[model samples]
Target chain A: MDAIRTEALTKHFTVGFWRPRPYLALEALTLQIGHGEVFGFLGPNGAGKTTTLKLLMQLIYPTSGHAEILGRPVGDVEVKRRIGYLPENPYFYDYLTAEELLEYFSALFGHSAAERRRRASALLDEVGIGAERRLQLRKFSKGMLQRVGIAQALINDPEVVFFDEPMSGLDPLGRRHIRELILRLRDRGCTVFFSSHVLSDAEALCSRVAILANGRLVSQGALSEILAVTIRGWELVVSGLTETALAHAQSSAGIRGATRLGPERYALELPMTVPPEHLLAKLVAAGATLVSLNPLHDTLEDFFVRQVAAAPEERGLESTRG
Target chain B: MRAIGHIAVNVFRESVRDKVLYSIVAFAVMLIAVSYLLAQLTAGQDLKIIKDLGLASIATFGLLMAIFIGIGLVWKEVERRSIYGLLTKPIRRWEFILGKYVGLVLTLLVNVAVMTAAFYAVLAYQGWGVDELARRAWPAPPMDPALLSAIALILVELMLVTGIALFFSTFSGPFLSAVLTLGLWVIGHFNTDLRNFENVVESRAAAWLARGLYYALPNFDTFDIKAQVVQGQHVAASYIALSVLYGMVYPALVLTGAVAIFSRRDFK
Candidate 1:
């Protein structure tokens, strides 16, 4: 069974005022997240990423439809007991020491006194807060605070962990540590759902991704399948072409697109089907020498822009498929 | 229940660390000392005046702690975004509110205890006329019987105020909640006078409206037996029992409403 599933899940928030209209934040978002997979959700700002997380966590009520976690309805206490959430820009009680904060959360999760101390100690160490567990949160830097936030989320040994923009505001080293932690969580057979706007991280870490735009699920599936349909091609450059040769080369159209790259050099885009030699020989026959040939592949970002910009019906097909 | 206890413990610790508690304690002590000096000015009312002032300070300071700190408790959680972490746990919203209320009450209990001890120390020191020479220098202590009754009344009063503060916190911001709670306190203090005025009204409809308002507001004066205790009148245990019951029931009603509103609120 999927660790997470949503069918026709929708949420509308009413702006409380004299004259009001409900704003739809998530429109019929449906997807299934399998256990032990790192599912990446990529979207620009206000694409309903945070709203989806909020609804899943039951911080706010959904207008219609339903979402389930671990076979239980969303917001069920049993489901909540197995899930951990790290909110974007998490804030903590400034007066609490790292150890104290973890202990507090552990108790809330029904950990015994002995288990609370043991787990808190281990988590503090795992998050690299071993040496400064006694220091108050106010004294810690932003990166340290983030580490503590992660520790607090993991205190329950949750089966599912949701991280909303976990890498925001972190230094390069901090970002790498978070990525490693995410990998470690996934390795432990925990279902990890994290949201990010940066496509590189999603491409590198996620086996599958869901892209959202304007509060709608645009595309979602295995990263490979999403890219397979979007074409991949290479770039070719040629130089020393006369006006008649340029006209001939342009008219022949062996390459997909030919545009001037330099004073006498022009760049040609060729589909992967068209071999580099055929394009080079064509340029040579047309009285132009091949200057540069480089292959370019489609990235997750390129696919994101294309998928998010596509028509609604076509976009929904990618997300709704099993 | 365990989660509530955990949150309560943390809130108690945080509140104790605030400088305001110590300042209130020090101020109460100073008030008790000043009462002794002021009592010296009145030849025969030393003990009576000291007891009145001491008990009054305890009640006032305790109320201040409850209203000011309770307003900030939930507001602080929202402002710092800690509510997100708490909500994600396996705890209910009512538990959070209950825990915060318990923690603030605990803080008030400690602060009031300190002031009570200081007041007792002052009374003990002044009760025994020092030496003949000291007694000659200082005026004789006054005989007061209502001090105990006043202290009991103050406890009941603080309970009611804590409830008011928590109820206001459910739907209002810190500043507005504080103001509303203070307004309730002021109205409650003169609740008996309002009832008496309501009784004297000539028009039946106007009297009914006045009576309705009086009953809707907390009848705080019913808890006070200070005059009877001070006058050396025999105050019945039933009076204290009834006052404590009144204090308990009103706050429970108010807290129920607070929890109802809080449970439905969307913490976006």
Candidate 2:
């Protein structure tokens, strides 16, 4: 059974104090996420990423359709036993210490006192909370609170975890820390579903991805499949090239173009059809030296921009993209 | 069951840590002490005045704690977005509402208990305050156990107020919730007028509306025994028993509404 599945799930929020109207926060969104995969739900801000997570969490009711986790319907109490969730910019009860917060959540899963203590202590350490720091969460930094949020979510040792904008509002180091933790969860064979507007973070962690724009599913598949992981071309940087050799290199059928890098230095952009060895041999014979040769593949960021660009009517909303 | 307990315990701990609870309780204690000075100004009626004011202080302050803190019981979780993590847990939505209500009631219990003890202490001190005054006021000894009956009803009233606060907060922000809860509390004391309201009103629709509200609104005045307690008049045990039953049952019904509203809500 799929770890998570949604069928035509939709939500419409009645906004405005007066003359309230139903605003389509999320349209019919259908998704199927298999077990034990790190799936990234990629979207720009206001693209219904958080709205989707809230629906799956059953924090809000769906206006139409339904969802299920581990073959159980959403809002099933038993299904939550196997699932965990960390919200965007998670806010815990600041009156509680990190351990206290974890322990409290542990108790919700019916853990024994000793088990609760053990789980709280272990998860706190796993999330990088020190043993000596028993300060209330209100006193902790944002990064520290976020760490506690992760610990609380994992207190039940869930098999599937949902992270709503996990790396949001974190510094580079903090983001890296969460990225590594997510990778570790994936390594443990836990299905990790996370929403992220930051494509780069998703790029390094996701095996499969689903791009969402304007509350609709734009595309979904393995990252390599969607991005069409083919070598676009080679970036060839060379120096010590004679002017004749440089012009000859630019004239080559495989060479896309050449630009002078500096004195006696020129870089050539080549199509994938260009043979690295043949180019090197010809360039060597012409008294040119190779500095660097690297293949460039399609990037998720460019693909994301292209997808967003394709939807012009909705393009205006992309101005607030994160 | 366990989830409710956990949420309730957490709410109690959060409320205890609230400086507002402490400030209000401390202010009540200070006010109870001030009652002694005010009582002295009345000469012969000093002891009676002290008892009356102390019970009044307890009821008023307890109501404040119930309204201010109770309005935030569920609203705070929503505003802080903490409910995002909580609702995803292996617990029912009704459990969350029940837990918050139980937790806030527990906090009110502790607050009322402390304020009651302080009030009793003030009465004790006045009883032994002076030689001539002590004998004069000692017809049956100053600290009557009947005062506890009044405090008991007051606590029940406070619970009802907290439940009303929770009920409104399910569908409204803290501001509107407070206003509505307080409005109900004030009108609850006067809703007995609605019993006779149908008799005075000319319009049949207005009478029916008044009767509906009379039945629907909380009857806070039913719990009042302070006047009888202070005057040393006998109050039937049956009256307190029925009032307590009504108080417990009313909030439970209101909380049922709260849970239904909360369950249907979209926390967007």
Candidate 3:
């Protein structure tokens, strides 16, 4: 069974004060997510990424259509017991310490006191919140609170987890830690679905992805299928090159983008049509040393930008969809 | 039920750690302490004056606690976006609404209990008469357990206030909720006036409007047995039981309404 499925799920919000009009927040967002896959829900701000997660989590009712998780309806209590959700910009009662917050959440799931204690301690430690676990959440940094948010979501050890912008508001190291955590969750055979505009993180972590633009699913498929993962080009960093040779490489038609690194070094990007060996031989004959060569491919960000840019500017907004 | 308990306990913990609650309790305690000193100036009415002031302090502070804290019970969760995490849990929407109500009620209970304990401590001092300073004739025993019956009614009244506050909080913002709750509290205490409002007014429609409101609004005067209990007059056991039952019944209905409204709400 699919870990999550939505059949023409849509949402419309009534807006305006005097003359109310319907605002389309999410279109007919029919999608399927299989078990044990890290499905990336990618969209720009206000693109209905959070709205979709809210729909799946049953925080808001869909205007029309239905959603199911773990082969059950969206609001099934038993299904909820097997799933975890981290909301966008997670907020918690700042009065309680991290341990107390987790314990309280565990209690909601009916965990025993001893089990709550063990889980809270272990999760807090695992999230790198050591001594700070004793301090109130109000004292925690945004990144620290994000960590706490993840720990609480995992406290139930859910089979399917949904996270909304999990990598937002984190430093580089913090982002890396969360990335590793997502990979670890995937390794455990847990179906992980997360919404993010951070395409690089999605690129690194997602096996499959769905891109949303203006409340519409613009594109979705396997990473390798949707993106050209094959080497599109190669970058050769050359050093000790003569000025005349550097100018020749810069003016070469085959070299797409060339940049001068330093006094005697230059980096040249060549398309797949241009063999790196030919460039190397030419550069070596011109008394240049090849520092290193690396292959480049199409990134998720490249696809995402194109998709969002090409998508119509919110089509059929005047009419309603069911 | 278990989810409700967890949410309630967390709310109680949140209330316990709040500095505002401490400030309110401290001010109420100080007012009760001042009541004792004020009673010394009255001749032959010290006991009456003290009991009146003490009960008044408890009721006013308890109402303040109920209105202020209760108004935020749901509003805070939604405003801070904490409800998003909670509604996704393995609990029903009615459970969330019921849990919030129970938690705020529990917090108000603790506050009322603390204030009641302080009031009793002052009464204990009056009874013990620190260092043989006693020898004053009293209208009633200073340490009256009957005071609890009055205090219990006050708690019931606050419970009603909490339920009404929560009811508004579910559908409205805190400012509007507070206004509506305080307005209802004021009208509730003067509920008798609404019943007899026809006598003061000339218009028949206004009188019927008043009569309609009389039945529609809570009769909070039912819980006010402070004067009878203070003056050592007999308070009927049946009356107290009926008032408590009414108090419990009203909030249950209000909470049901609250759950209905909250269940259909979108947490945007």
lDDT of 1 at A158: 93
Model 3 clash pairs are none
Cα-lDDT of candidate 3: 0.88
User: TM-score-based ranking, best first?
Assistant: 2, 3, 1
- Deviation from native of the Cα of residue A292 in model 3, angstroms: 12
Q: Give candidates' CA RMSD values in order.
A: 5.8, 3.1, 4.4
The docking category that best describes candidate 3 is medium
Q: What lDDT tens digits, residue by residue, belong to model 3 across residues B1-268?
A: 8998888888888888999999999999999999999988988787788899999999999999899988998888999999988887899988887887888888878877888898888888877743333433555688889999999999999999999999999988999999999999888989999999999999999999999999889989999999999988889999999999999999999999999998888887
- Poorest stretch of ten by lDDT in candidate 2 chain B: B133-142
Instruction: Give the DockQ-based CAPRI class for model 1.
Output: medium
Clashing pairs in 2: none
Question: Model 3: per-residue lDDT, tens digit, A1-322?
Answer: 8999999999988876798978888889999999999999998887889888888888889999899999999988998899999888899989989999999888888899999999999888877889999999999999999999999999999999999999978889989989999999999999999999899998899999999988889998898888765568999998998888877866764788878899888888999888888778888988999899988777888888989999878553443221
DockQ of each: 0.63, 0.82, 0.69
Ranking by lDDT: 3, 2, 1
lDDT assessment of candidate 1: 0.81
Candidate 2 matches the true fold with a TM-score of 0.92
- List model 2 lDDT by residue over A7-26, tens digit each: 99987777666666666767
Interface quality of candidate 3 as DockQ: 0.69
CAPRI quality of model 2: high
